[model samples]
Target: MTKKMTWNEMSPSQQTGVLVTGSIQLALAATAWIDLAKRPAERVNGPKALWAAIIGINFVGPIAWFIWGRRR
Candidate 1:
């Protein structure tokens, strides 16, 4: 079986990478949420409340919104 390394056991670079990835995810989610909030109800493909909940979901939620929620 493979040994699992705890956070304290990870190398500095590995930890940095994890932190950076997490930060990016947060940023993307925030941006998507803000954009959704600023959009008028008529411009969104779905209901504003539904999009708000969807955007709260981790990485995939924001991506889905950008891809499917916004009207062309």
Candidate 2:
């Protein structure tokens, strides 16, 4: 299900709000990487390897939500 979305219809504040939220969440998501790294400690896998997994979750979910939410 979807609704039509028009960028022209959104106020500047709406766009700004999305951007601000995205950036703040992005920063916080880095912590998820830190959390992931800790899990691998004392194991063979490197802590930094978790960075990829963390970034994947961090970026994908919100992007999907924002894009779909705009349509509605």
Off by over 4 Å in 1: 1-5
Per-residue lDDT of candidate 2, residues 1-72 (tens digit): 887657777789988887898887886556544444454445323334544443566666334333331222
lDDT winner among the candidates?
A: 1
User: Residue 45 error for model 2, in Å?
Assistant: 15
How many collisions between residues are there in candidate 2?
A: 0
lDDT, candidate 1, equals 0.91
User: What is each predicted model's overall lDDT from 0 to 1?
Assistant: 0.91, 0.53
Please report the TM-score between candidate 2 and the true structure.
Answer: 0.42
Please provide, for model 1 over 1-72, each residue's C-alpha lDDT reduced to its tens digit, 9 standing for 90 to 100.
999989999999999999999998899889998999888889899798998898888899999999999986
